[model samples]
Target: MGTKPPSPWDRHPSRSRPERAHRERPTDSNASMHADHKRELRLYGLNAVRAVFARRPEAIRKVYLNEARIPQLQALLKWCAVHRIGYRVVEDADLQKLAASSHHEGVVADVLREPAQSLLTWLQALSSDRHCALWLDGVGNPHNLGAILRSAAHFGVAAILLPQHSSLALSGAAARVAEGGAEAVPFVQLGESVEAIAQLHAAGFALAATVVAGGEDVFAAELPRRLVYVLGAEGEGMDRGLAADCDLRLSIVGSGAVESLNVASATAVLLAEWSRRGA
Candidate 1:
């Protein structure tokens, strides 16, 4: 007699169970590539997700919420329902998996990143005699960008500029760090330094390159009324050619034993001083 049909659970050498769809991981290389190309990010943490919803709900594509935080996110949920944005009540583990991080405080959002416009186009449209902008040169850290944006927003910076190939593209981490400045600031993409310098000069913006030395002390220098401050990466500062084209190369003076401050901290000090002078 044929043996009882092999049970579905029975481990057979020839038969294997189909993989569960839910088990797919975002950590896979292909998934990471997709995230980069799609300009999408999974933002985690209640405050982070809440801030996006409060500031730019339209940016939110979908939300995966932990069941436990339903009460806290009521307003957001109501808005999602009204907007027809899909949301799912998920287990904490599911959220952790989606974020690929343990820091998710019970919420995750898949949001659309607003594409940055060219500086030439955006600059022409924006008419201002006195405005401040930040240019990041090789400063690819998301957290630093977020911090700079926070300071920029507080001090009324009008725009953020980056090179055509800058790696510091907007990300959820930066947005979360900004605490909402991401919605307030307009990021502008610029071509090479020479072209950008000419364009800024034509637009009547004085460029200031921040450095550790060989420049006027930020406290003593007279900052420009319409200025663009360029900061560099963690170890390597601004390129020499870029500095040469800048109208002013300024240095922040500090008495700390450390050689230099981090980019974010330096940005706060500089923006504060500039704002204080009404520049």
Candidate 2:
């Protein structure tokens, strides 16, 4: 399928760096305290900003910037102005204090944690015609999450669900790497992977686990129209109970020259196969 047109929010031109996108939060009593109750988090990069703005704007309370970084923050500021979001220019040192892991890249947006939803509710809402979902468990690397989302959107997978206790937010790098795939696909965070899998099975979804050992050969296995593909983290695969719960454990046939495929790469291969089977 051809790439979908750019989202309305993505029409802005790229300057020195991508602009951040985000929504606003109220400054009143209960709301302010709620925002404060959560740790003040900082997010850099354009797409991460966009995800916050597009998905949960109220969680974003402030945007800190520097005059020299004006171009990098133009679009985001414009978005804030139009949406009545709060912002101010602060010192680079202040930006440093707010952002934890990486360079603030001349911008940092204060945001509340992105909320997670149930896998069951998300799945139940999909049309019967749209029945495939990518279920990720313990796959914490943001890059891997973004890549898998990109593949899921590319293959028209119905939705992508991550365990609630696991890493589910679209991190800075993941957002950039997703190239807006984060917006195209619906996302959910589950309370427990094992329970979610069991519920999915009960709902008639044929659970397929990507595995390294004995299981059905992915390419040769006939897949059900309604399917959920479970992918585990790097090195270790899914836990025993979860693996056994799946309707089918699948391996991507290889020469064994390598022990196994990267979790993200394996997901891509499996999702592509499911899409192909539908075709």
Candidate 3:
């Protein structure tokens, strides 16, 4: 048969993807924090802000958009007006300042961040036997995180499990890149890795460590009914100890031209395979 057509999960092998106009760096400084003791998040881009308005209108504290975007955001503006929420029509410069990014796409909003769910709470609420989640070991890039969230939402992933003390919270750039997926998936904070692993096992989840090489082919392996794909940091890869503790190790068999796919791309491929297997 001829080469199969590329699916949505397919990515070009070239590493020439265009970089964003600005980098969204994470910081604990006060300048990075939003209102209400940093409980709020500044979400920019049309889809990011619009998703917040559509899903949780009351959480939107303020909105700033250019005059040109008014027609597109009529419903959001009307909702703001009805709720007495402050919204301003300003120049693109002002919008950039408000969003702290040049790629704000003419709109921005400050919305209260949804609190993370406890692992036990999420586990208790999981009603489906066939479900998948991502246990992000050290994946910290906001854009990558956003891409993962988008894929997770597309594949019906149950949650993004964050390890205790992991500084990887959703950023504005991540949310913007997610394109409304941020509202669809929930993030669960995990406790100790040992305890978390045990809890996941008890909840009928098999933790599979995604490795660069020397692991079972993910495409051919029998996936668990309930699974958690453990993804690691970009450069360092997964912690050796954690990988050893995992129930199984899996690798995405790719052309050897490159070392491996980025965490986000790999996640999409893995999730697609898992979803294809009817997980």
Candidate 4:
């Protein structure tokens, strides 16, 4: 008889018999670590870490730093030791790994994530007639958010309002960029846009939609004593329906060389004008 044809299974034994290859499943410790990571926020940068320690030292779960940072962080380390919090004095490479960024500034802290406050609670607490807040309609860039927080803190903004279903959350990179402003500003989670608008109206606050063009000049306009500037995301801009519902619309009126200032830069100008008027 002619040589028997080789079976296809013989040519691909590994595929035919999958059980021959052993795959290791994640251990319980690995799974637990992942769950812990989800519950914690990795705050890096010297100022960012210091701010968390200053504001909520109890929230800090652990810390990692290079030897060079020890002198500057002696107080923090002492607090950590006293509280029995875990800390590691590792090399630069380990610090980078823990921070997930090279800009860790030689220190990193794992702390419990600060939860956003409800709109109703925040509104109830706002007794000041001369107060300002930001309604970030869709500004999701971390760097932009950080810059905005820094400006907001500098201008004494009351809060940062997040719309329903907003993906914006404080992150390590954003906190680092904020340079401790993250600790100064509180994020308020909003409900439905229309309902939230009504609530603000009831609280004697006016909403101003920031547009690229076809709006009152921000410099000359009479901004409300209690106002919320609705800033949109880059490129796509704010929702048209939301913009239409705003009490007023304002434009920065910059030189036509570029379309407009960055959202963060525009916020600084707007806040400055408001502060100047209130001053």
Better of 2 and 3 by lDDT: 3
Tell me which of candidates 3 and 4 scores higher on lDDT. Answer: 4
- Clashing residue pairs found in predicted model 3: none
Over 4 Å off in model 3, which ranges?
1-37
Clashes of each: 0, 1, 0, 0
lDDT of 1 by residue, 1-279 (tens): 121222222333232332243545666876865665488767776766877787778878777777678778877777776776667767888878888777678888888777898988888888776788998888988888889888888888888898878867777677677877777788899998788889898888899999987779999998878888988888988888888888898998877578888999999998898899973
Instruction: Name the regions of candidate 4 deviating beyond 4 angstroms.
Output: 1-36
Candidate 3 per-residue C-alpha lDDT over 27-143 given as tens digits, one digit per residue, 9 for 90 to 100: 555344424537888999998898888899989977777878887888887777666666766799988887789999999888899999999999999996799999998999999
Task: List, residue by residue over 56-120, the lDDT tens digit for candidate 4.
Answer: 99989878778788878878887876776667667899888888899999998889888899999
TM-score for each prediction?
A: 0.82, 0.71, 0.86, 0.87
Poorest 10 consecutive residues by lDDT, candidate 2? 1-10
Comparing candidate 1 with candidate 3, which one achieves the higher lDDT? 3
Candidate 1 structure lDDT: 0.79
Of candidate 3, the 10-residue stretch with the lowest lDDT total is 1-10
Judged by lDDT, which candidate is best?
A: 4
lDDT of 4 at 145: 92
What lDDT does candidate 4 reach at residue 47? 93
Scored by Cα lDDT, where does model 4 land?
Answer: 0.87
Cand. 2 TM to true fold = 0.71
Per-candidate Cα lDDT values, in order, are: 0.79, 0.71, 0.87, 0.87
lDDT of 3 at 117: 98
Q: How many clashes does the backbone of model 1 have?
A: 0
